[model samples]
Structure formats: C-alpha cells, structure tokens
Target: MIRLAILGSTGSIGESALEVVRRHPDRFRVTALSANRRIAALAAQVREFSPAVAVIADDGVGGVPDSGGATHWARGRSALVELAGRDDVDVVVNALVGAAGLGPTLLALETGKRLALANKESLVAGGSLVLAAARRGGGELIPVDSEHSAILQCMRGSGARDVARLILTASGGPFRGWSREELWDVQPSQALRHPTWDMGSKITIDSATLANKALEVIEGHFLFGIEYERIEAVVHPQSIVHSFVEFVDGSLLAQVGDPNMELPILYALTYPGRAEDGALRTFDPVASSPLTFEKVDHGAFPLYGLGTGAGARGGLAPAAFNAANEVAVEAFLGEKIRFPEMAEVVARALETAPATEPGGVKEVFEADREARRVAREVSEQLQREGSSRKG
Candidate 1:
C-alpha cells in the first residue's frame, strides 16, 4: 500500500483525496494529515484516517483530540515540513493553498518522496527550485490539477521533440462574456458560483478573473518544459475537455472527462498503474453536450496577460505575480476592493516590485514578501482613491 501524507486536509482537494483513499482502502493508507486553521475538521479527519501524524497551523490551540492517544500531533509550519519529509511517507500530497505549500513541496522532493502536487503556487513561486530539488532527490513530481494531469496523460507515448504545442482549456468562468463595466461590481458570491467544477472560494475567484489560467500556464512551462509562446489557453464552456496537446504532425490529442477532482487525485496516487474503479465517471460522447472553444479576451481579463507575462520574464517575476495575486484575492474577498481592482493590484505590484534571481527558497520567500507588501500598498491606495471619488 502507498503511504500518503495529505497536506491541507481540510480543503477541497484534500477532502477529495481523502475520499479516494476511502474508496481504495486496500491500495493506499493515510499516514499524515495537515490543516491551516480548521482544527475541528482536522480532528475529524484524524479520527477517520488515524494517521501517524496530524499538524495544525494554529498555535495555542489543541489540534485534533488524540482519540485513544494513538495519533501523533504537531503544530506550525515547521511541523508541516517535518511531516512531509518523514521517511515512512511514500507519497506526499501537497494540497495546501497559496505559498504555504511551497516549503513542504521542497521538503517532500528533497526526501525523495513522490509529490502529488495540487498547489500551483508552489511552481508559480519557485519552479526552478522545486524542479532542481526533484532532480537532486530523485523523486517523482506528479501534477494533481486536472489540466496538467490531462496533458500528462496525452503526452504519454510522445517524445518532447515530437510535441508541437499544448492547449489548456478554461471554463471561461461565470464572467466569461462579461464586459469590464459589467464585472466592475461583481460580488464574491457571484464569482464563487463556478459552473464547471466544485472548487474552493479562492480558486473560484481566480477562475472568474482568469488568473487561475495564468498560473496554470506558468505551471505547464515547468511541468512539461514547454515554451510560453507554444502554450495556449482557450475558453471551453462545456468543461468536458480538461486539456489538449497538438503534435508536430498536426494531430491533436485530448483528455476528456467529467470535471471531477477525484479523477486527477486518483490518477496521481496510482500513476503508471490503472485501477478498474467504478466510482470514476465514464465519458459518453453522445450524452455530453457539444464542445466549443474561443479565443481568450485579454481585454476582459487582464490578469491573464499580467501573470503570463511575469512568468515569461522568469526569475522572481512569477513569484511576485503569485504573491501579489494572493493578497489581491484576499482583499477582494474581504470586500476591501472592487472585483476588478484585484487585477489592478496585481498589475501595480508587478510594475513596482523588483525582479530578482531566486537562488533558493529563502530568496523566493523574500520576493514573495516584497510583492505582497507592494500589492497591499497598491490596494490601500486604490481604496483611498475610491473613497475620495465617492466623497
């Protein structure tokens, strides 16, 4: 059985991963679990999984009650890295949201543990470093995201040289056809209603603004070693086609399935081996609706350009972009800024933040800190300007 340590156990991806474990109890075992601030949920997961280790991000709060005192409990970020690097953990699923997952991602790779990566920010913030660690430790890095997983499946038998381009599909979000004026005042609730997949609020917001696609573009670059120009994102409303690849011979390959995170999670867990499970939905072409694609309108969602441009610039640019977007998303969720202003804050941070070569995780964190600082400053300035105009 594959021993699994699932970070962000309380979040959407983590929950789905646990469900996969529930279904395939004979093939996999949960060895460790971690949560940011949801101790109650963490406690419940600990009881159910009875993992060897459970970590909580909050301090001064008792984590999951040690039911019968059999489970080990740890607290804070250091514990997260330690648990990820444990010798017993065969696969480390880094599902923690935002930059918080980066450290454990590095640790898991450094310890030669298979990393099932769900947190795209880890790559967006420190792609070079993460890839280097994976190489040095001789660990496998498998993407848990549906799009990357689809691309991985499609590129199985093809050589990198034989591949011509990659096509990533987006659901176009709930605001797919909305004009700038129409999206200016969209509330967080409206953005959270994703039509295609059930996701956490932060990702749902990122999808609405198309920032999630930008992050995926950068992630594709590192995962597949592809050039930014060759990677493309198109609007596919049906959400049937997760992603596609075009070979040098003009032949296109696509991975089409129901928009369920469980499929990707299961794939990551048992890669190179197929499980004949009935729980996964089989795609029916006739029953499925028509598939359509459209060119992404950069004018409607400028975050796409801003993030992809920063990624192409390389170095700390991607890190800064990721950090700025995280802060901007929080501000928008808090109602401190308008929905459109999240993009503005990220753009402003990117413009002002200095781009540097990230030599290691420390340098990446420094760049992240600087970018978040700039994003917050820009957000405050926008808030003041809005107040003045109102007055």
Candidate 2:
C-alpha cells in the first residue's frame, strides 16, 4: 500500500484526496493527517481513515472525538511539517493553501518522501529551497495541480530537450469578459462564482484575478526544467484541456479531463498505474463542444506579467510576490480594498522588496514575512484613499 500523509486534511483538496483513497483502498493508505484549526473535521477523517497519527495546527483544546488508534495532537504551525516528515509516511501530500505550506514541503523533501504537491504557494515562495531539499533527500516531487499534472502526463517518455513550451489553460473565471470599470466594483461574491471548478475560497479568488494561472506558471518553472519565457497561459472557458506541452518537432500534446481535482489526486497517488475512479466522468466532446482559446488580457489582469517575471528570476522574488498577493487578496475579501487595488498592492510590495536568493528555510520565512508586511502597508494606504473618496 502507498502510505500517505495528508496536510490540510480539512480543505477541498484534502477531502478530495481522502475520497481517492476511499475509492482505491488496495493502493493507498492514510498514515497521517494534519489540519489547521479544524479539529472536528480532522476527527471525522481520523475515524474514517484510521490513520496512525493526527496533528492539529491549532492548540489541541477543541472537543474532537477520538478515533480508535494512536492519535497524537501537535500544536503550532510547524506541527504539519513534523507530521509530513515522519518516518511512517511514504508520501506527503502538501495540500495547504498559502505560505503556510512552505515549511511542510521543505520537510517532506528533506526527509526523502514522495511529495504530491497541491500547494502552489510553497513552490512560488521557496522553489529553490524546496528543489534543493528534493535533491538532497533524493525524493521525487509530483505536482497535484490539474495544469501541471496534465503537462506532466504529456511530457512522459519525451526527453526534456525535446520539449518546446508549456501551455496552461485557464477557465477565464467569472470575470472573464469584465472590463476595467466592471472589475473596479467587483465584489468578493462575484469573484468566487467560478464557472468550471469548485475550489477553496482563496483559490477561487486567485482564479478570478488570474493569479492562480500566474502561480501555476511559476510552479511549472520549478517542477519541470522549463523556462518562464516558454510557459504561456491561454483562456479556455471549457476547462477541458487542463494543460498542453509543445514538442521541439512541432507536436502538441494535451491532457483533457473533467474539471475535477480528484483525477489529479489519484494520478499522484497511483503513478504509472491508472486506477479506476468511479467519480470521474469521461470527456464527451460532442456534448461539451466548442473548446475555445484566447490570449490573456494583460490589461485586465496585470498580475500575470508580474508572476511570470518573478518565476523567471527564481529567487525570493517569487516568494515576495506570493506573500504579497495572499495578503492583498485577503484584504480584498474583507472589503478593505477595491478589486483593482489588489493587483496594485502586490505590484507595490514587489517593487519595495529586494529579491535575493534564500540560503535556507530561515531566509525564505523572513522574505515571506517582509513581503506580507509590505503588502498590508500598501493595501492600508490604498484603502484609506478609497474610504476618503467614498466620504
């Protein structure tokens, strides 16, 4: 059985992962599960999966029922990392949301466990550090994102030298055709109304801003030995073509599937062997016809270019960008700033923070902190101006 440790067990990806494990019992086993401030949900998971251990990111004071096994509660942010690196875990699935995932990803790679990564923030924040950990620990890293997973499938058997470019498909989000004026008054509810995929709130927001695609581009740079210039994003409302890879000899290969995260989760768990997932529906081209593509409007979403540039640099720059965007997005969701001001805050934070190569986890953490602080300051300044105008 493939022993697995799931980080962020209460989140959307984590739940989907558990469902995959449920479907393929013979191939996968849940050894450990970790969650942040969701003891009740973790308890439910533990009772069902019967994992060897469970770690809670929050203080273990909640009234979580016990599962019929050795369950130990760990407190603090680093608990997830500890759970991920445990000797019992053969594969660590980093499904965490933001910069909080960086440490666990580092530990999983450092401990030489196969990492099925769903958390893009870890790579965007500490790609170099995480890659070095993978190298030192001799562990293989597999991406869980649909786009990266699709690209991974297409690149199989093809030599890295034979690859020409990586093309990522976006769902165009809910605000796909909205002009600048329309986006200025866009509310959080409107942004969260995704057309194709069901995801966590932050990711749905990122989808609307096209920041998710930007993060994926950075992830592609680190996951595959591809350059940022060669990675492109196209708006495909169908969301059928998860991603594509163009060969040097003019062969373009793509992976098409239902817009479900479970397929990628299962692929990561059961690599090389396609398991029978009854949940996945076959793609019907005739019924779901009209697969269209268009160039991304940089004018509508400025964060796209910023993410590409940061990914190209491959240093603390990506970390800063990810951190700033996280803070800005949170502020926007809280109605602290306008939709357009979100990108502006991230751009300002990037301009203020000097990008440098992080020597270790400490440096990466420091850069993330500095970037978040800068983003908040800039966001507050912009919010004050907006309030003044309203007054």
lDDT of 1: 0.91
lDDT of candidate 2 over 1-391, digit per residue (tens): 8899999989999999998888888888999898888787888888798888888776656764544456665666776678878988899999999988988888888889989999999988988888999999888899999999999899888766888999999998998988878899999998888999999999999999998999999999889988887889999999999999999999999999779999998898777668876669777889778889999989998888887877776678899899999999999999999888888988888885556788888888888898899999988999899899999
Show how many residue pairs clash in every candidate, following the order shown.
Answer: 0, 0
| Model 1 Cα lDDT, one tens digit per residue, 1-391 | 9999999989999999999999999999999999988898988898899999888876667535654576888788799878889988999998989998898899899889999999999989999999999999988899999999999999998766778999999999999998999998899989999998899888999999999999999999999999999999999999999999999999999999988999989999888777767988677888787879999989989999999999889999999999999999999898889988999999988986556678888889988998999999999988898889889
lDDT of each: 0.91, 0.88
Clashing pairs in 2: none
Q: What is the Cα-based lDDT of residue 297 in candidate 1?
A: 86
TM-score, per-candidate, Cα-based: 0.97, 0.97
For residue 85, model 2's alpha carbon misses the true position, in angstroms, by 1.0
The count of residue-pair clashes in candidate 2 stands at: 0
TM-score between candidate 2 and the true structure:
0.97
